[model samples]
Structure formats: structure tokens, C-alpha cells
Target: MCGSTVERFFRGISEFIFHTKLGVADVQLVDYVSDLMLRFVRVDSLYSLRQSDGMRTKHVVQMISEAERRIGLAKREVYRHVGDFTLFWSGMYPESLSAKKNRGESPDQLIDYCRQGKRAYAIAAEIEGGADRPSSELIHRMSEHFEMCAYGLREVRRHWEEDDDSNGLLTW
Candidate 1:
């Protein structure tokens, strides 16, 4: 049987079209909520979180896990610069990320956020490489994916700012 579109979106890099759809929206909300929930004292596993609409629960977990795995697979060893966009690998982050951690954000929080962005850029590059032929459209789509990762980063930044546990790390 064929994989779900969202699964293909994660696993089948070449064919993954970055469409603004229900999967993207739901994953954003779910991830954002998960980020927020993580700030609290941990009491349960992510899979144990209450499933209001239980139907898609398994799919959500599977999707995230697969994406994370794919991101790891797609991660690059050397820093790649595409035009003005400089993409960093998992262990190596950008200066902006360092500034965030230095300002007051928890290292863990910023690390996770950077990793997410890395995943986005890596997947975008993978798709572009797998394309039949290079086109401006492909570049545009990759840039859009990169921007989506930035958007997610901003969300996590806000979450970090609001946490009561944040001590001196509140330099805005």
C-alpha cells in the first residue's frame, strides 16, 4: 500500500511538495502545544498526552518520528551555503542561535529549535536534489520550507520567554 501524503512528504524527499495543508497546520499546532507542555514538570510520555480526537493520534506520532529520523538521515556534515542562506548541521548551530542561548533562553530549548530548522533546510535541499531538473520554482519551494522552520523557531522563542523557570536568561 502507498504511504499517506504526509508520510510521503517526510520520507519521499524528491516528491515532497511543500503544500499548505491540514497536515502542516495540525503538526504546527501539535508541535507548538508539545513545546509548551514540555515546560511543565514531566509526568507522562508524549504518546500518552490526551487525544481529544483519537483517530489521528497514532498518525501524529508516526509522522513526527519519521520526520525526525529523516532529518537525521538528511543532515549534512559540512556547513552548506546556498546563496545567502547558510544552513548548519545539528551539532553546529548558527550565530543567531548562540545569541539566543546567551541572552537567556535555555540551552535545551534553543537547541531543539535549531534542530527543527536544520531538519527543514535539510529536507528542502534533499527535495531540490531529487528533482528531475533544477528550476527557480524548486528553489522558491525550498526557501518557503526554510521560512516555515524560522516561523517555528519564533514560536519556540516566545515559549521560552514566557516560562517562569527562565531566570537571568530574559534578555530581549
Candidate 2:
């Protein structure tokens, strides 16, 4: 495997932030909370790459696979920080969709372990229902996935603003 391809998600996120001026202005502030920010940024970048209009060459399949893989990995990392809604919907909003479960660590909490990367193909299976699903339906589900990711990014924005108390908003 190409080392650069293996690192595409992180590099893509940095590139996206640099080009779009969407990154935090001060390195110190962002680095102070790198653990919380990295997963949120990586997943957002992966999905943004997926929705890109770039022409698919022979290697495009790998990019899609990488996006799906990174999404799962990000979800897992986020799960370690908080239960429910690794991809969104469960805890991103002003209110919980249901009574909150026991609060896990919030994103601002620090950790020292590297998480395993994964793919969401099985998760997709749950949403897609079966192999015979129509192309349009799959496309719709993919779009929903993107929207949920946007919410996930928004949640990150909220956490950044209330770093010490992010769990308070999330626990609602």
C-alpha cells in the first residue's frame, strides 16, 4: 500500500483547512484540543472528498474505500469519547433524540491510545437493507450519510466553543 494513500485522510484534512481557511486561527488552541478536533475534522474531510466532483480515474475506487474506511474509524474514535451517534443524529442537536445514556468521555477528554481504523460496509448493510437495493436508493442513503456528517462537524464546533462543558450540552 502507498504510504501517502494510507495517510490521505489526514493530509486531505490539512489541505482542505489550509485552502479554505476553515482551520482554527491559532495552532496552540487547536493543538490544546487535538484529540477532540482530529476525528471531527478527519471524518468531515473524508466525506467532503466523497462528495467531490473530481473525475474518477483508475484509483478513484480506492478513494471511496478510504472515505468509507475513515468514516468508520472516525465513528469508532468518537464512540470512545461518547456513546451513541458516532455519525450524528443521536447527540449533535439541542436535545437528545431519546433520554441520554450514561455519558462516556466527552471529546475534550484526553487519551493516549491509537484507535483501529475500520470500514462501514456492515453499517451500510444495516441502512441499505439488501444487496438488491436500487442505485437511486443507495445514492439517497449516501446523501443522508453526508448530511449526518455535517451535523457531526457542527457538534464539533459546539464542543470547541464550550470545551470544558461540552458534555453538558451533549448530556441533555
Candidate 3:
């Protein structure tokens, strides 16, 4: 896709980790996850889903409720956003969730991120009518392999932490 240097950086690391270390050779999945990482690097992108009052939706339940109120591609995209949201947090920074829980700040304390993520992806994959089969199939595969992808993301975080040159790269 000839993205920016930052995107390329994420793609390179994601490819090496997901394909080589994690044995997930699906190029589409790797690309999707890499792009997701790239997108979520920004605080605004991480919480891009907004309410009618223009407030960012912080909780997954609220996101799901909003998704249910939509129709067509918009609904599908919101569901997909939910999946991405859950995966990004649960995979990349699970320890933060624990910390939040201990401090009584975990908004999703009673919710299961993995189950909701997989279900959201499945719902997203089922939407639309063959207008974009490739994306639908990719999202479907994401649902089927959600756990592996989440594990792969955890490994990605570990690999990045072990690398000394990755400092401040994701800040941009």
C-alpha cells in the first residue's frame, strides 16, 4: 500500500513476528494486524468511535450498543472497530487491564474481551452482500484465529521491548 515510514516499520516487525516467530503465514492477517497497530498508535485513533454528542466511546458495551443502532456498512465497521479495540488492548497491554482492575478502574471488569472480540469480528464478517469478499473473508479469518492473533500481538510487544532501537518510533 506504499504507506508512510511508520507504517512500514510496523509492517516489517509484524511480518517477522507473525510470520516467522508465530508461524502465522497469512499475509492478509499480518497486514491487517500491522495496519491496526499503526492506526492505534495514536490516542485519537485508539478511541475513534464516538457517540452522538461527539464523545469518544470508552467502553466496549457502549460501542456494541452504538453498533447495534446502525445499519449496513456503518454497522459492520463499528463491529469491526470493537474487535480491533478489544484485540489491541487485551493483546498489547493486558497488564494495564489488570492494573485497572486492581484500582477499580476497569470498565470492562465483568466482560470477556476475547469472546466479545471474536463475536464482533464474526458479526462484521457476516455483514455486506459480496461487495467486498476479500475483506469479509479476512475478517472471518480474524474471528477464527483471534486467539492466535492476540498471542502473536503479545509476542510483538515482547519483541519490541527487547529491541533497543524501537524507542519513540510509535510516538509519531
Candidate 4:
């Protein structure tokens, strides 16, 4: 699907699951999660952060390490990416964890995505401070309700899977 088509699809499903089904009325939270799904549709966006050698950082631990090595806005962005990465995987494609383990992917196999994701968001929120009040608040809400968001995404996955027309639209 094209960018606008994918965005519309995710936005519609996210609205249905989060607002109607889950009873979550936080519009910003719903929009953030939907935007996350839309962004992750592209393989490049899924692992957009690069390492020193120019490799896309694939592991949560590695991303965290990279985040720690930076400061200020860069650090905050990296931590935010870590949160987004963990949330996307654990919420949408949890079954892929075991596959990653079988492939000898490190750290993530032994760690909790929810924990890391929540902590990462918290750090991002703290780093945000008064410079961006709205963004910080949204990130704080994300940290406080990471599990709910993750559960909502899982519901989204289920909803799509059960739809007759879903077919290959969820290949990501």
C-alpha cells in the first residue's frame, strides 16, 4: 500500500480498537500509537538508527547502549527509538521473539520489552523537560500506560487477522 493508504488503514484500526474496544479516549495516545504503526510499515523505519559502523541497530540492548553514548536531544531521540522498537515488536509480533532467540539474537531474548520500553519512555520524558511540554506529557503518558498500549496493539493485530480483507496487508 502507499503511504497515505497505510496511514489511513492504521489510523482507522487504531481508532476502533483503542477508543471503542479498549475504552481509551486519549486522542494523543491513540494518534501516537497509530503513527508508530504507520512509521514501522517500512523496513528502513523499523530500524532507522545506525551504529558507529553505519549498521542499523537491530537489538534492544544495542540500541540502549547507543543511546547511552549520546547526550541531549540525540540521547532522547535514541531512547525514544528504543521505546518504539520494543513496543512495536512486543505488541505486534511477539511470536517473532522466539524466532529471534532461535537465530541467536542476544539480550532481547532475555529481557522484557515492556520493562525496557517503559523505562525508555520515562527517560525520554525526563529528558524532554520544559522545552516541549506537550511532547513530554505524551511521552510520560506512554511510559505510564505502556502495557495498555501494547495490549491495544495486540488487539489490533487480532482484529486485522480476523478480517476477511486483511489478507497480506499486515505482512509487516
Mark the regions of model 1 whose C-alpha exceeds 4 Å error after superposition: 1-23, 26-143, 165-172
lDDT of 2 at 6: 24
Give the TM-score of each candidate. 0.24, 0.20, 0.89, 0.88
Q: Identify the runs in model 4 with alpha carbons over 4 angstroms from their true place.
A: 1-3, 102-104, 129-134, 165-172
Give lDDT: candidate 1, residue 123.
51
Over 4 Å off in model 3, which ranges? Answer: 129-134, 165-172
User: How many residue pairs collide in each prediction?
Assistant: 1, 0, 0, 0
Whole-model Cα lDDT per candidate? 0.34, 0.33, 0.88, 0.88
lDDT of 1 at 102: 82
RMSD of each: 15.4, 17.3, 2.6, 3.2
Q: Give the number of colliding residue pairs in candidate 3.
A: 0
Native-referenced Cα lDDT, model 2: 0.33
Model 2: how far residue 44 lies from native, Å: 17
Tens digit of lDDT per residue, candidate 1, span 58-131? 22223333344443223221111211122221212345546655876433333444344444444544543343
The sequence of per-residue lDDT tens digits that candidate 3 reaches over residues 102-142 is 78765777788899999999999998735554388899999
Selected candidate, larger TM-score, 1 vs 2: 1
lDDT of 3: 0.88
Q: Which pairs clash in the backbone of model 1?
A: 104-169
